[model samples]
Target: MDAVIIQILNGLDKGGAYALIALGLTLIFGTLGVVNFAHGALFMLGAFVAVSVNGLLSLESVTLDPTKLTPWGTPAEIRTKLAEEWFGTFGTTLIDYSVPVSIVVAIPVMLLIGLIMERGLIQFFYKRPHADQILVTFGLAIVLQEIVKAIFGANSISQSAPASLAGTIDVISGVAYPTWRMVYFFFSLTVIGAVIAFLQFTTFGMVVRAGMADRETVGLLGINIERRFTIVFGLAAIIAGMAGAMYTPILSPDYHLGMDFLVLSFVVVVVGGMGSIPGAVAAGFILGILQSFAAMEAVKQYFPGIDQIIIYLVAIVILLVRPRGLMGRKGVMET
Candidate 1:
């Protein structure tokens, strides 16, 4: 029972990320009918945003302290962060909370990137083949990855949550889990709920949904469907960036972080069904849990490498059974 609970929690932790990324992918596919292989790069960029903010907050000013002598009797150099030097405790607070604070920095940056990518590049491929879209976006993803490697170097950048969230808490009398992970899970839920509410409740969301159903009809109704779709693309990028930013504490980000999640996110999207938000969310949690359970010692003993191939295996079976997906509507990817 304890093992089951632990695995379930672990699954949720992993599912949060999967669901978030898959949601954005679904959004782009549903709205633009473009297969964005570069979506993962948006996630990587968000992590870098956290890294950049941390670096900014930790910018150091150095001075020679005549009063403080070194062991060899030479004057010692004092180095202090600019934030600490200028704002004292306030600067310290900023540094401590840099990870969460980066969310603010990532939003506009990601939105702009998304908008630029959609308008400047992706728009050209709207009438092109899916293979062409995939090739271009995949090339873009590689370009983004290389750019990050050049700037930040091919190394992982570490980030941490606020000190208050750095420890573990007991969910039950005998079950303790990392506080940051719990926070991340809840934060993901809030963001997901917010996105869903926006889509399901707002007039804009209704219009977007209608456009998704029949874009030509919506355009004929005097709605600027193209503009709305572009905005939706930007919104999708924001979601991916936010996910990447919040995920830094859990995984130190590398230049290839985007690619690492890209394939899996695609698998999630396929299993969820193309252009289905609810399906994406549901498949994310299901696959996450299945992957978690497959990692168990008992399961591993019976089936070696199950952990690695669990998601793919499930995808194959699901696709075989339900050609669309768990909740997929027909004619989505019909050729």
Candidate 2:
């Protein structure tokens, strides 16, 4: 039915986000062999970057004159009257232009942050034990969240899509679908495609893949495997951050969004398997669609608390049956 189709579309977008985050997680786990618990924080940082970009763009000055004449050389009195009626110096002057411009600004800023975190923090833990690595990255995640809070304040930052994307579109004769949500879906798909292409065809990706297979031999051959791992971590952070940035319109940026996403992302990664890109992508969509099915108004009425249990229930069943996950490698977690 129309309702079912609609929910499936809705779930795809959420799945796209999950796929993106999980893909990054799988890449790091497969290549660097490090269980990064800080990935959620990176996602949080991305959303904050969008917020920061929006805030920065708000600093622009319109430089309007209350008494200035118009293109038709309208009377100063009329112009002044209009300005007095509709304008204020204290409030936002560029509210219309801020969101679109913020997206452009958030990317580079977040990429730089990603590089810094990888080079400075995550790199050190690459050689450490899983427990130490987990603690360090978890601590780093906390630190990152605190830093975001300190800068953006403890409260969530308000942001939404541009005016052009604020409303809904009529997909059929009777239904009007939300434009921002559609845009989010498209944006996430674009990112996921680019990432998949990078992993599938790029030389750098090939090298990383090589390293993932046998890092010891790759290092013995004189390649800087550690440096590649650092880059991988940074790349992972950038992916999470971009996802966060684009998600601002869907969910406002909060200090805890990182942790929020981190948990679901981990589930996504695990359900996909330890290091399978296809698995991550597939599981993300599967879980997303399943979530949608569970949230159905009719289904919820019958299942009672279906939304709360659907994901966990599905995960448990998958792990019980697949053990290593749908596409998981036999030796992945065992070693």
Candidate 3:
């Protein structure tokens, strides 16, 4: 029972990332009718944003300390973070919470990137074939990955949660959970809810949702549906970026981090149904939990590496059973 609880929590934690990424993917697909292969790269870029901010905060100011002499040197050099030197205790605390604080930087950066991507590249592919869109976007993803590798190198960069949230939390009598994981899970849920509410309740969301249903009709009504869709694309990028930024502490990020989640996110989108937000979220959590269970020693003892293949296996089986997807509309991919 305790083990089951543990796996469930782990699954939710993992699922939060999957759902967030897939949500953004679905939004782009639904709004602009574009399959964005570069979405994962956006996620990677978000993580790097956190990395960049942390790096900036930790910039060292070195000064010679005559009071502390080295064994063979005239004096020792004292190095301190510029943030610490500038703000003292407040700066130290800010640096300590850099990972979380990075969101502020990430939002604007991602929004700008998304806007440039849509206005510059993706807008041209709107009327192109899906294959072309996929090829171009995949190429873009590779290009982005290589650019990051060149800038940050091809190694995993470690990020730590704040000291206060680094410890384990006692959830149940026998089951303990990581504090950061819980924070991440709740944070993800809140973001998801906020997005849903924005789409469902607001006037702009209504127009966007209507455009998703029928862009031609919405445009015929003089709504400037294309511009709204562009905004949607940017919004989607922000969601993906924010997810990646928050996830750095959970998974040390590397250049290939985006690619690592790309396939799974696609699988989640397909299983949830192309353009189906709720479906994407639901499938993400389901697959995440199933994958978690498959990783158990008892299960793997019989199946052998089921954890790695469970998601794909499930995808195959589900597609066979339901061609469109679990919640896909009748004509989504039929054309």
Q: What is the lDDT of residue 165 in candidate 3?
A: 97
Give the alpha-carbon lDDT of every model: 0.92, 0.79, 0.93
TM-score of each: 0.98, 0.86, 0.99
Supply the global lDDT for candidate 1.
Answer: 0.92
Across 117-169, the per-residue lDDT of candidate 2 in tens digits comes to: 77777677777888888898899999989998888888877787777778889
lDDT comparison, 1 vs 3, better candidate: 3
Minimum summed lDDT over a 10-residue window in model 3 is located at 325-334
lDDT measured at residue 187 in model 2 versus the true structure, 0 to 100: 78
Candidate with top lDDT is: 3
TM-score of 3: 0.99
Model 1, 32-138: lDDT tens digits are 89999998999999999999999999999999999999999999999999999999999999999999999999999999999999999999999999999999999
Predicted structure 2, TM vs. truth:
0.86
**Pairs clashing within candidate 1:** none
lDDT of 2 at 278: 86
> What ranking of all candidate models by TM-score puts the best one first?
3, 1, 2
Q: Give the per-residue lDDT digits (tens) of candidate 3, residues 70-128.
A: 99978998999999999999999999999999999999999999999999999999999
